[model samples]
Target: MEHTILSLINQTNRNIFLTGKAGTGKTTLLRKIIDTTYKNTVVAAPTGIAALNAGGVTLHSLFQLPFASFLPTYGSVPLANELQRIENRTSLQKHFQMHKNKIQLIRNMELLIIDEVSMLRADMLDAIDFCLQQIRRNRLPFGGVQVLFIGDLLQLPPVVKQQEWEVLQQYYEGMFFFQSKVVKEHPLLYIELEKIYRQTDPVFIALLNHLRENKLTEKDMAELQRYVKPHLGTKTDDNYITLTTHNAKADAINARQMEALKTPVYRYEAKIVSDFPEYMYPIDKVIELKKGARVMFIKNDPTGNRRFFNGKMGTVQSLNDERIAVLLDDADVIEVDRYQWKNVRYRLNETTKEIEEEVLGSFIQYPLRLAWAITIHKSQGLTFEKAALDIQSVFASGQAYVAFSRLRSIDGLRLLSAVPQNGIESNEEVLQYAANKATEGQVQQEWEQGRLEFLQEMAMRTFDWVTLETAWLQHSSSYSGEIGNKNVYKNWAQQQYAKVKELVATAAKFSKQLDGYFRQGASVEYVCERVEKSVEYFIPLLSQVWYQVMYVLEKVYYQKKVKEFVGELEELSNNMGEVVKKLFRLQQLMALAATGKDFSKETVSTERFEALFMQIVTNVNKQMKQEQLFTKDKEEETPKKLNTYEKTLLLWNEGKSIAQIAEERNITESTINKHLIKLIEEGSIVADLDKLFSKKEIEELSPLIDALEEDSLKTVVEQTQGRYSWDKLNLFRKVYLGKE
Candidate 1:
């Protein structure tokens, strides 16, 4: 069946869908095709964590859907400006033009393979198909693209039931009919690969197969005894042990596994419903000292008590003490203590900081390694290397069968518990409904008809080119010697062999059928044409042109408004420039004197500088108050409350640009410039005036600037004394003369 499916895939002109029971190797085959044939393939899963597990991007991220939101933002997608930002490389540009430009930048691509197809909603698939069609400008679905959908039918269905699933069901029903017919008519090379490698015991395999067939045998009960028996001897490395739910089996099994290696386990418990205590020290302090540390935590507490009791499981995070962290399969970080650290268990190296940064700052302390765990749901799709399954728990219809058959090789399995046949219920109503919907027969007919048509077309297209090539190879003297003869023989052999095999296979498979089975009127070209047309018909329906047009119109309108607004803002700012200059000058001088720079023998003291600046600020407030520029209540307020202008003045003194101070304080820098303009109006502070400073003033100002830059008052004082004459300075003379 695998080879026939591969042949069909090689010939199919449009998209293909593959579906089967769970654990059917659909994903495995899809990956094989991608690795061997498709080079430029992008694989995506529906959910983020699932994508991570599959080593692919999520469908939501690929579609650029907003996380945690229902209403999708559409219309003019913005192009990330590479010249404007460094991180824009991965950023998806919003506009269609930009998206096209980015697509054009890609060098080579052949296919897009989507896995977990059963979980995909029809609308989401349609959306993806739409985007591809528009970008490629081809009259085919996904722009004449080839897609392979791989998934199992029995696993969890799409989450959105009403819209997507219903649409998908209808579409899949049509495809399923086509697939089933192809399998029946053709020599479909289906490979079941029933060898359960994970569960090696023959008895266990028989038990599992029986259970899968809905027939539990007595041998299954006997096989489970090995796990249940009490041990009388020292534990052998290969000995199997069973832990019960009441016995706290999961944790005990984990502990025993670790103890076999002579390693200690670090245990921590947390109330899942409440916050972890603040004083509980972090895990890093304990695990750093030891290697191969086994850690277990309570996953669920059924009692609902405040404290943890039973129902804990052993889940180990391999710790890399060199990196000071433990690595979880989900790529979560846990800083571990020294004593409980496990070095041998983890793969350690210098972390890939670049890859970490690419993932939008998810802090992964250590790189990932393959993990082993029993997630009942996820285990459905996998065939393990070895398996130890316990099916003593209640089986809900198909659950037991699905769990048992997960083992591929008979010898690779160990059935830890017996299946209870009495547990199986024959729900006749449910069975009847399923039987009615089994449309598998109809699907098979359509698929066979499609395959026959495709094969007939290929056979008709075969020319005598191979015969001509073989003749040429034989006659050409340039290919003389043993190598030439060998090459000629190889060409002739391959051509003759292929021709004979195709004729014999076709005759053996189809000759037995009656005249009506051939469907003589139905041509392969017609089938191909029908498939092509079906794709083209959906192209226009999926195009998002209206959304794009609306986005473009909105963008143009906003650009015009922004241009006008910016112009008015610029003009207002220019008018306030002079005021800003004057205020800055006064603030700078006062700031300089207040820093204790000795200007002269009678230079202003630091106290006097501060007092004078405050007085000046007070006077400005009073002036503004007199003009009633300030809105006031009838009650009197303090001078501090009245001094609104001082906030702007202080901002200037702190070396803030006039524009910045205005924005922060929510006032116009122009208004601030107006106050400075007033200072110029009164000739209190000069505009663009570089006054010739006395040596005393320079000495004082330099030290203050140095102090501010260095953030040290003591250093400023030392630099001041070294540079200036203390004997002649007024403030210095006062101290030296012993005057109060």
Candidate 2:
């Protein structure tokens, strides 16, 4: 069970299906992935409530897919008229053409995480697949992107219209997305969490397991009926939440309960400061609350102080035009503050391997919801300490199971009507699948082994970096150390490794956490997050710090290369952003140590040499602090320091490769592509490009390359498919594309 969950922590980018019975921490696992992994992940759910619960967007809202019952059933790109019709129907044409950025976001996506997977139908999933392929211009499944599916099919089955089902049946075996043609062809690896975390009573747990496995018997039904009675008692503070089959029925209970309070009702209209005000409506545009009304916090506290949390229920003690007070179930009364919900777009910083959010707009309001009585349909991702059920009102399959499972224990449940012995139903296909998965304990073991292998590989790579750092410090320099001290460079190297050693040790902590996670999924992803922070974010920047030293040393031996490097710095500084001030200062040091300067003896009066050297060191040190390179909770606290294209190219000119530049800059290649496009348009590197390729070659390649909008080597390789080598493509982009 631990491996089934922990295994994804280290696994390379791949599609995975995380499924289990109610309250198995599926949503918890998704949050962990969002907190740890470096991939550009976008999350979506089939329903708005599910999307908010998942802290993501709705599938339709994110993709702008049509609301039609069936998706287009075809393998090829639609003709012009067909596309036009789709555009007119869904308004996707303007979005696709007007939003170049939206296209880039989709094209560069590494992971698309869908929560509450059971509610997404086969046609809808195929439709998403088609949209991705069309936007990315790739024919591969999901446009060659990795997707994560999270939810249990046994709880909620997809809604299939008769027409959609008829169209889907030709391509899918069933209505579930797993039965879709693309999924059938490229099946995602399954990981079912076996541990039950929501319910504590073993006997009650056994009944839930039987429900999931389709093994419910008359005896189990009799056990369930013990709590079911003809008349439910009057509402009390401890009464379980009523579950109904219909929204209207649930609304009736809520209205009646609120009216029963006989307290003054305050109606507050939400203030939306965003473009999509209608979409921002979670429960409604106007929220009605009364004193003594049972209400739940719809969002976590902004600072995450835990004074309030999503799904935490309480009673409204008082309210006015300027204030609101809530008494939590724990009897602690606190003034409630308004929180802002932003509609954010994320950009992956390839250099940092961190997701950066751009706040497009926001909805500012107190996140409180009426909680006296909620429908079983609306109660789906929530957990309750106490609950009541009206199983007699259940109209669809799995509704009863959902209603009963919200309670923490059987003792908390009070059912208001007799339930049929065979009233509850689960998807038989899912039950059979879970049954089969139950026997494959080997898969879980394999997951553990794979984790060990990834950790070992990381350890080995860390060792290689240490070796590279040490050799560069010791052997690469043909000259002596800082003036008046032959060991000045060696001392600098020592200082560098001391930091490296510290970071490596910081990274090693994950090994212990992996051990802990192998036994219990630790609530805090301490190791996964710290390792990601240490290696991906900090170490790369640290490595670039060493590369700076190399750049200075290289200037003495490779004068021409050093000249090219300085030119890049000067040109980049000349462009729109701030100058790489430290590197700009380093250029002066290189000027003093030009072509044949001997450093075997003290050549400088301490004042000049020490002053300049100290300045360089101080500048580098200051940048590290600004970036918060050593902070443990930087991901949560610090704002990102983006590496401008000029600085990225300066590192490039220092002989660092694109991958190294990405590490040094802390951003991704797609993001890097955006920077380079701006650089080309700015004419900052026109002279450099002229030297790399002839004008004729540049002209010939520029138009041919224009056919492909992106400057990535992969795009060139993919479009030309070996007609040109990577070197040629790289040189062409560097020399030709941004002609001045």
Candidate 3:
């Protein structure tokens, strides 16, 4: 089965879907395929923790989806402006160019392996399909791209509203459940992996199989009890065995399994389940912890999987009597009160600075550091070299099994204690969860079926006519001289026109498909129902296209042309004002008419109007003749030179104050004053002379007074005590009013 799956993945034109039980090496196979086949590949995990474990980016991040928000139901359809912007962006341009290059390089490629496919809701898959299709510009499924989907349908399904999921399920129903007859007809490659790799103990494997089949016998229960027994003295000397909530059993188990150091481990070196107090430690204490200081810090939130420095690593930077500053190699430096560090013991290395430099250098370039202690959820896609697991602790879920199975080999597994079976609930809880999911899936399937039927029917009826009309319009426009020679200009116009037609046709088709799919029955598979419900997803795209098309035709074609004409007239008026003055007058009349204002009743004879226009034209011609003559004469002469006072006045007019002129221009203040006085005497400048006490020239002096008051108040307020409130308030008022 594995070979078949691997072979399909290797095929140039095949997309493979693999489904099976958990611990069946689905992810393992995916990793192998990625490592072996595709070079320029992206491994996108659904969750942040999963991505971290897989050493890949998360799906949401890759899609640029809003964090913690529902996925957008409608696919992205770029507007003309947005498309242009995307074309201009260096990153996107590079990405597109690279993909084009890759296509040329490979000619063909291997599968796009998407692991945990079951966890992907129908809508999410549709979104992925939409993006791929758009980028490749291919009409076939996933842009005719080969995709490998691996997941067990029985496992955790997508997290979404049940109704939304149902809609998506309906849209993809046909593809989800490929009947043998249908499979033969379409020839879709499907492979199932059966062998369980993690639960190698025959007895253990048998018991799990029984439990999975809901056929656990009395012997099975007895075996489970025996398997769950706790081992004595397994905990490290410094590490205490502690339980949090029954829900955290998995975390406790994993925490206990971490390898213990042999270096005289102090009780403070480890903590079982301790909560770090927020804001209790001072900043200085955080900076005092030296390198080689062994420390174990507890993360209170089970889901808070901060990679580094969330109370994890410890290294000293500086120390004082009251506080110590410690630096986390990954997280920023923090200071804690010296009193807070009293309980923790560490032998500070004298050569801490050298060690710090070495450690900091190692991590200086990386974005984030590897986490020392991680939650089981964070361990999903990770395969550790060695893992220590304890199932006896609190809050253990089925996820514990999943985490344990992540290790590639059994030799890497270090069991801290026997796996606990006590908290295992009756099959009812698990069955209920599965039933709810299945029900949601059914709803989605029904919606998808309905949508498909509607699309098919609509395609046959309304869409055919719409598409025909669109083709005729496109043909007419192409042959017509309306489109110009510029490729960008022509393409932009065609796209605007085509988008509307495309939406109308797509909507009609979807409507027909929905009608056909749901007309038959309701007891369809959950996946089918989910796909059917996705019909609404296409509605927004249709609406946007319709609006955009109408806007382009009405505004771009009609209004934009009018505006362009007006703009050209305005430019001509500015350049050839005298000759084009009549054009400006006509524009004013048009503007008034546009505003629904009455025009003047005055009328001129046609001959008189023509004579006036001729006179204006003659005047413009005469001015142009004089300008040409003046330019030739000016070029033949030397440039006029300014006297020192005139030069100083020019600088002053250019916003150089007397003081600045003196300092920068290397002139005396008196000389600058003399220049200013001469300019004023010449009547080229205006000022109140006696008050020309630069400070007394009221209008000119106001700015300086305001500045002085502002500075004086600022100094007084900064130096003043609380008891001087009245004086400070007075100073503030005086400064604001420029009365100081």
Candidate 4:
């Protein structure tokens, strides 16, 4: 079952929900997917700790979403009334101010793995959908990124305040992610793993299954009653961690036990280096431990020896600022070392043009935390050898089941109170959804069918020229040079852009023909033959045109002592270089597929893909760095070499008007105005209406710009005719749109 699901993830672009009972190796399967899949992927979870446990970032952190209850607005553009109701004016303003690099990350993402998705609210999922669409400029679900949701719907549930739910209920059927409006439009492929790896006792497994379905029998009740002991809560035990429903109860238990210890305390503070954010801290910054205190390991041992795993119960035998020893159940004492957790984000490597995870910072700390007691919510992915259940205050649907499932067997569980008849609860909505899940045979059938569709989509995408065209257009529009005649580079880029636009038209016609062939029930061999012809046609056209585009730029840079535009030149070269690499890879894949090879088990490796294009420049930025482009002018004091936006900003700060700066900088006034607007949009500089516009100008153009439905400055200028210049309209539009 796990093998089939893994194949679906790699061979198709389906949105999948991987669910199972607790201890069904869902996390194990997730690790396998992360290790082996060739797609550019991002992993996120609902909360910080869950994110830490899953080795990913938080959803809110990844999306830059305000911690607010979102409303399910239908398109990328949210309904104005509903948007105002969901978030405040300030947050909405901030949401639109995402950094350009973050926007690029969103555009480059191919797969998104959301761990512990049962705790993801319906509105939150819709908000993620909306965010991706707005940022990636694509309206497909999650901006055309395949999403994999991993969690048990029978374990943890999403948290929503009563007041928030009152407002959200009208827009949603329930709080789970399946109830999201977008998920309803494009339903997820449901695959559940049935094997239980945590517990092997048949009787215990039967009881858990009954509890999960809320179908407890009389025999199960009798077995559970045997562990009920009212006096157990009063006892102090170091071997068993107490699991409770509320944080306050768990905190009190841990605090009391800590205070009772008479041993001297050893205080250790975590070593944080560089850009680790406060919210994403995996463990407490400072921990105070005593010799006999109970501790729980929060991370798996870094060594392959597997001496200690997460949630392993032990007692602190000895500790210091640098070293600590833990005694496990079998009288084996092991020395524990500090573990480092890396905070990472996905980025496109300029040299390789591959999406890679870049480590932003790391937090080094001991992996142990107080294990006297823990809340059931925090114990979602943890397992225990012995635990006491204190569930009289259970509040959520699966609270009791989550607490009970943490133990290996009934022998490891001690009940502090008799289980109420209604304690083993399951949401009716979850039950109804689970009942409709396809059987194993049906899943296999769908998987086989999806494989062919996946091949078709891959072939279509290879023929689709939109991505390459967009890259060329963006590069051509943003091209700027500090040395030589800038028109030379600009004209060349424009010509290439024009060529790409023409190719886009030609590819669209070819794609339509290919679709017709597929619609006629063409065999794989027939389609591969068509793909082979297309590849042979496009390969020479792209390779011959783009092979020396970067080499020419390199030669131009080497001939001059230009330092101001080194970064910009490299960036432009890299953008074009990435396009060339992608085009070549697409052709290569199509050529390979023409051999009638199966792609289910093996896809194109990076090495093999690069082997096809090594004759082209492998790394445009490598030589630039080695030459030390900026060192020669270090002592010249050339105002620190500002970018176009920065230069425009500096001139403005010197009280120069837009026209004056344009004349001084030898650029168009419209380009100068655009630079300042870009600076304002990035929050680098604030716009002052009094400094930017005259009263007469504001009073005349403000109403017109405000009333225009579209926010494009060129559109506003066109409507007003040649009377008003684009520079004036651009400034007026920014102020009127409240971006200032």
Candidate 5:
């Protein structure tokens, strides 16, 4: 089945719906696709951490989509809340429309891989589909892009509010991502991943499978009750996690555990630099780091080393102004540095077809969470060695199941609720869906056959080039004469583009000479004569008239967005028609001038011209952003092109010493050193041997660095005690075996 799916991946037309229970190698398969696929692809998840785990961006970040719990700001208007909602909808649509880069990415993309699809609402999915259709200019679903959704529908349901769900109810069959309008209509092939990678014990696995399937027997419950000991040692001292249904209870437990520590709490205010939004900030704004506080690592170590995984537990050993020491359960004291969690919004460059990462902002701090206890909802994606569950408050269906499944074995759980009313709370809707989905094999087979038939019909049908069916295809031809065609589209486009350039050059020169105004006979006659004289240039152009054509081209040239001119020509009309229209527009402008029309009045002054230019350019520039011919024509007051972290990476790549980079960036050398040290810790940059220190020096210095008891600058400085300059050691470490 896996091999069949791999073969299916080679085809560009089919959407795949991948699902399995928790720890079922779904992420593993996605990682493989990301590493191997040659297609222009993107990865997005419903949440920030999920996106980070997939090495992608959030769906909201990718599409400029709004999380639809509307915050109204209205006073005294009739139906003001509804009006505000409408206004918000329009604004969000405009937001999506404005990001030309993102729009183009949607249009040009081949495969879009979305993780944690269950958390994705139906409206969000529709938002993506609508944006794609708008950008690609094709009504065929999702701009004809194949999307891969990896998530377990049985684990988590989309959190739709009562009113929102009421609104969405009319449109969708149900709230599952598979039930989303686009996915439901579009024949997505479901591929269930059967292998469970995390839990190997057959008994535990069977219980989970039964529980997930909503077929948990009375025997299973009795067996579970046997593991529910009255007391499971000292919970305060042990590393056992507690799962509660309510946030308040979890917070109380955490607070109680923290208060048990007699040590004074050290309050550290997180330094704000970048434009870090609330959604992306991993830790608390005011981080309270107390000695012996139980903390969980929020980020995986960059080097793919399992030493400090995202959920790894450690205790704060000590803290100071510069650094904090952490002691892990495995008898290792690792120096933790202030980590940077980026909230990046990505866009695909069409010209080069390279994916560019735009840092929206970032949260820089130690990736630690106060993890004494957490709510079951928050613990959805996490696994624990041992867990304590307070199932007395399992208000929602599947809540008990979710809390139970967090543990690897029945032995790891110490349930506080001795007896609940029902054996296991399962949603009736989910149970019904599971029953119906059991026969999904027939549905998928029929869907595939129908899909193949549709494609075959398109291939065999008589060509009516303008129809929506063939619009997704770049170019189409009549049924006959495959061999006789000599690339008409390219040939025609080039010839017409040349004509436009000539006409535009004349108009450009004439505009400057006229002191920004056109006169009726001499200049108008000159422009009109130029257009009338070119016979083949201004012929057979349809859809757009000459005024719009000439007006748009002049705007394009003036705005320095020349790369998108060809695309604008294509948008106006096809290649041959495009050139003719360009010529016609100049003729119309000349005629208007002759008729004493002051079309250039509001556009005469530089300020007005700039305003007019901005209006025209914003719309056209957005379209051009998708065309790979990118330019350096950045907008006024655009944020810094390169972020501080990106700049550090660039300077390091150029082989500039840390000091030189520090001087160039106008920051302290210590800051640059810290940044470089972070790169090393993340395992992104390895030390290059002999670049700063000899192999003998490295061998001698290895133990000295290790004896400091943590990978931190403060500890290193403390150990050296000013005998050796820290810069020498930093330089030495930077180039020491960094290449791997």
Candidate 6:
């Protein structure tokens, strides 16, 4: 059954909910999938602690979302109040302000794994969905990214304030992630694991299953009553840790136990090697340990010998600078080594055009924490051989279940207080959902259907030009050149952008035609004919026309000798080159599909892509040389290219307004303004501000630009309601600052 689940995850793009009871190896399965999957993947968790446990980043940090409750912003429906409305607007604006690299990272993702999803609120999931849709520009759930949810629904419930729920109940069915609007519309395939590695006692397992469903009998109560006692052992006992319902109580117990210890205290400080943030520290920066203190292993043995595992209990035998020996329950003492945890961040590699993870820093420390007491919330994901439960005051739903489920067997459990029967049950809605989950037969059928549909969808989307257009737009918006060669390079880039835009529009229409054929149940040969025809039509346009332009840009880039522009040009060229390679790959795959061959894992070879790329480069170079040869023949009659600054200066001296000069020269007003700014900064010419803005407009904007807190032009435009364009504002700022 686990193998079938792994196959579904690897072979198809299906959204799945992978769940099981405690100790069912869900976390272990996640690590396996992350190591083996071929897709570009990212992992996110609901909170920082969970993120650390899952070895991923927080969902909020990954999405750049504010730590505020989100309400739906679509449609004309009003929010609960004006404050909520304002916050939603601000969050939307922040989304717009995301860095291009971060945006690209989200766009490149193929699969997203969310851990500890039981604690994910319905509204928070919706917020994540909205952010993905806006960033990827796709209306499909999670913007077409396959999502895998991992957590048991019976462990812990999402935290929601009473007032927040009062307002949210109008929009959502309940507070669980499964109740979110997106999940409700596109239901996830359920696959629950069955094997329980922590407990081997069949009777204890049956009792736990009954407790999970809120169906415990009188006999089960009699079994639990045996464990009820005033105390499990003395404070010096190393076998049991108190699981309380509140953090303060746990803290007090741990503090009192530490004070009672008369052994000498030894302080150990972690080594921070680099850029790990303080909030994300996995362990304490400084740990104070006594010789007799009880400790739990916070990390697994790094050497793979499995000498000790996370959550294993031990007592400190000896502490020194070089080694710390812990005595385990089996009367064996082993030296614990300091383990290193890396702080990783994602980045897009310009050379390979792929997203990769970079280790920002590392935290090296001994993997132990005091285990005298711990809160039930933090006890999640930890296995215990013996636990003393103080959950009589359990306030949250499923808290008692979580506390009890952490134990390996009924024999090791010691109840310090009577179980709170009212809070010991799962949510009724959750029970119904679990009962109605699709059986294995249904899931297998769905997996077969989904694999077929995934192939067809991938084939159809091969013709889509959205990614190409997006890459072009991002590059054009961020490209800037040095003053010496700014105009020439800028103009060339604009011309290429216009050409790419036209090509993308044509590609969009062709894509829709293919979509129509698929909808109309066209013959495989007919669809292949259409696809082949598109290949013939688009290949030359891309390789010969588009690649030729890039070729020219490359030549100009080198001829200009501008060092700062090289990185930008390389990025843009590689991005456009990837589009061409994809097209060639599409043609090959279609050819294979026409013959009824399996092309599921097929991709165009890099050798073939480079052949096409070099073919274009060679032809373009030959043509340019021929043209230059012809120019050399007519050198006497040819005119030298005028410097852009001198030409703009001539126009400025001729009493031509900025707009008129821009129109006559066939350049943008913004470009013209940039030219003027360069001229002023170089002390070439300084003239009228009246032609650009009226006296009242100038007076109004001058003070705002002067007194502005930040050096942002976009801020200036926002304050004035965009009445002034970016070009005019930039020109004014240059003049005001330079003159003063």
Which ten residues in a row are the worst by lDDT in model 4?
Answer: 74-83
Model 3 score (lDDT): 0.41
Expressed as tens digits, the lDDT of each residue in 1-740 for candidate 2 is 54344345334334678787788888777887776554467888997667756777778866777665443443433333322222221433334452545665676576788999989887678778877877877788898677889998877788865644554455567778787767878777787776788887999888877766657888887887888754754374763567777888778878888888888888877677755446546666678888888888777777767787666778899998768899988888979887776665555442222245666666777788788777887787777767778777665567778887877788877778876666566677776555545334656655546544444343333323333334434432423433432233455545554655565465456445545553564422343444444334543444445445533343333344344334432222121011122222222322323332321113212233234444555666675565565565767587666557768667656766556767777877555555555665676544365544457756667777778656466866766667665655765665555432
The clash numbers for all candidates, in the given order, read: 56, 11, 88, 0, 10, 0
Q: For candidate 1, lDDT tens digit of each residue in 131-250?
A: 565555554556545566665433434554343333334333322211222222322222233334345566656665555444554555555444432323113233222222222444
Q: What TM-score, over all chains together, does every model reach?
A: 0.36, 0.58, 0.35, 0.76, 0.59, 0.73
Q: lDDT values of the candidates?
A: 0.39, 0.62, 0.41, 0.78, 0.61, 0.77
Q: So what's the TM-score on candidate 6?
A: 0.73
Candidate 6 collision pairs: none
Candidate 3: worst-modelled 10 consecutive residues by lDDT: 353-362
In the range 592-665, model 4's lDDT, one tens digit per residue, is 55564433314655564355356556544565565655655664656576788888888888999988999999
Residue 97, model 1: Cα distance from true site in angstroms: 11
lDDT of 3 by residue, 1-740 (tens): 44434433432345556655566777667767665542224555565434433434445544433322123234432333321221112222223333332332122221355666545654445455544555555655666556666665443345554444443344344222232122223344445566876556666566555644456677765654443324543333222222222334534443344333222211212111232222222111122122323233322112344433223434444544444455654446655421111111111122110000011001001111122334454344333434455444424334444444444444444555654344332233334323322233443443344333432332233223343344425433653454332222455546645654665565566546545544664322432333333323543343343333333333233343345433322322222221122222323333333343332222111233244344544555566578778988997795668888877877877776667877877977667766665666576555533333343333433453355544344443444444333332342334335341
For candidate 3, the per-residue lDDT at 348 reads 15
Model 2 lDDT vs. the true structure?
Answer: 0.62
TM-score rank order = 4, 6, 5, 2, 1, 3
Query: Higher TM-score: candidate 3 or 5?
Result: 5
Q: Which segments of model 2 are wrong by more than 4 Å?
A: 1-9, 69-98, 137-139, 233-238, 300-305, 348-355, 436-441, 444-740
Which of the two candidates, 1 or 5, achieves a greater TM-score against the reference?
A: 5
lDDT of 4: 0.78
Model 5 Cα shift for residue 308 (angstroms) = 2.7
